[model samples]
Target: MAAGDIIPVHLYLCPLTLPGLSSDQQGRLLDTLPLDEQQKVMRYRMASAREKGLLVRCYLRALLSKAHTQLNQSSLNQSPLNQSQLNADIDGAIGPSEWRFDYLDKGKPVLSKAFFARSQLVFNLSHSGDYMLLAIAKSPRLELGVDIERLRQNTNIHAILNHYFTRQEREAMLALPSTRQRERFFDLWALKESYIKAKGLGLALSLKSFYFELSETECQALSFKGLDARQARLEQAARLFLVKEDSQQTDLGNDPQQAQPAAGWQSKLWQLDDEYRFALSLSSTDPLDLRCEMVSAQALLSE
Candidate 1:
């Protein structure tokens, strides 16, 4: 990626196969939802969100069901409180983080607000085409955002960029060599969007305020708008990062400031399993020491 680029830090792929859950398995799961979550499900019952939410909840319950069996020969047909206690030791270690499902959480996740209503693990999730975009915080309790979109070859680049992007950004694309169509456009589009999501201020930031410049190895971001320039005071990205020979600027997730001009945000793009193109983003004061792991919903299931 060119400077001010949003590079993907890691990629995790899980199998789709899941063992069917029995009635006892399903019941044990819903019984763990907090009062508010239960009420929210009740309010949105029968909706797609409700269905997806329940599916994820059941996935968690299944994991716990297995765990319960291992810890003791306890049947999962117990009261909710008992199940919670029996699974306490496992929950403490595995916890909500293991489940990592945000298929129905609000905007960007706030640890406390989304998972269990007030925890602070800070992550965001979105899925497009056949992939999911997961933006996670390494630490420092920062706000994070990420997106993964498929390359629709026939997309009208001029139109979409004209509408969502500032004039200069569009010009950069037009001025590019005819050979750099799909890759360049997607890189710029992702960087612009990922930056907006990171700010958490939504569309309030204008595309013209910043520009992502492309270089041989990476992209760099520069702030044209005073608002974005001032954002540096908060250590937010006003530019992007491409890659280089040195490793001093490795983990942008924890130390985003390492990204400099002539190379925009530091992000990684990977072709995974021949099914999708993936980009993961992280913003931190320093490059994050991310412990990347690939786990299935089954791995997180309770005994």
Candidate 2:
């Protein structure tokens, strides 16, 4: 992959609580979804989760509508509805018929053959605490995966890291002089989780298969002695390793199939707020030009 070939990614973040939307207004947003999605929203056992689900779908529909309209402009032009009418029906522009989903063997979601074949877009959704994140990659599906976690104090960082992290990693973490060991632990966890999510295998893959070395200004993935070097080579060739303070080569493992082969894969981390850390993995070797936007309450709850 060309180092200068930048891949543009759109990331939308919506706070769980909207500024002016009421319970009734939120219900109306849920109504805009097709029955299946509505059922999914209603099935949530907790009110907070249910509201977050509803808002996510609303944001998703808005994103989908914008993307689909841009892709099929000719069809929109041929429609009887005028521009004003089309704008007014934004929620219904790409209706239920145009959307489709399938699942990976391990249950990670994927776009159906027909839908992706037409739009070539891939998206991943993640929510934690008070925020919901939706990521979209344009044509030539990026096979993206995103994750966010609120930094909480209850996690047993040392114990969990000792159990799951590689010896080298454990040593590194232990060696850190900073008192923020817990924060560092979550940073590693977020990156690892996002990497696996991007692979679409979730936690089914062994944590020992890969380990990361993270610092304030550098991040790198290192392979074990017996690890599959071929996978490492593929990651290097794709240039999908973590960011560093300077340009340097990174190693991968033997399994190319772990990530989207054609598109390769890349991972990123961002501290979105004081209490949350966000991680993103994308199936692209090109440098990521991630565009993060905060969706307004009015835009999401509007017709």
Q: Choose the strongest candidate by TM-score.
A: 2
- Candidate 2 segments exceeding 4 Å error: 1-4, 19-23, 68-98, 218-264
lDDT of 1 by residue, 65-184 (tens): 333233232222333456567576345433432333343222543443344332223455445553334444323335455555566678877667755654444665777787665555
For candidate 2, write residues 1-303 as lDDT tens digits. Answer: 245566657677767764545778877787788789889999999886777777777777687656555535544565788778767645434553347688898887767888777667677878888777777776464567888788888977877865566554567677877676666677667677777777788667656556665545443332212111210111111123332212112223333433322235666677654577777776666776555566654765555
Error of 1 at 112 (Å): 2.2
Q: In candidate 2, which residue pairs get closer than 3 Å at backbone N, Cα or C atoms, i.e. clash?
A: 228-254, 231-253, 231-254, 232-252, 232-253
Candidate 2: global Cα-lDDT?
Answer: 0.63
RMSD of 1: 14.1
RMSD of each: 14.1, 11.0
Provide the overall lDDT of each model, using Cα atoms, as 2-decimal numbers. Answer: 0.44, 0.63
Question: Which candidate should be chosen as best, given lDDT against the real structure?
Answer: 2
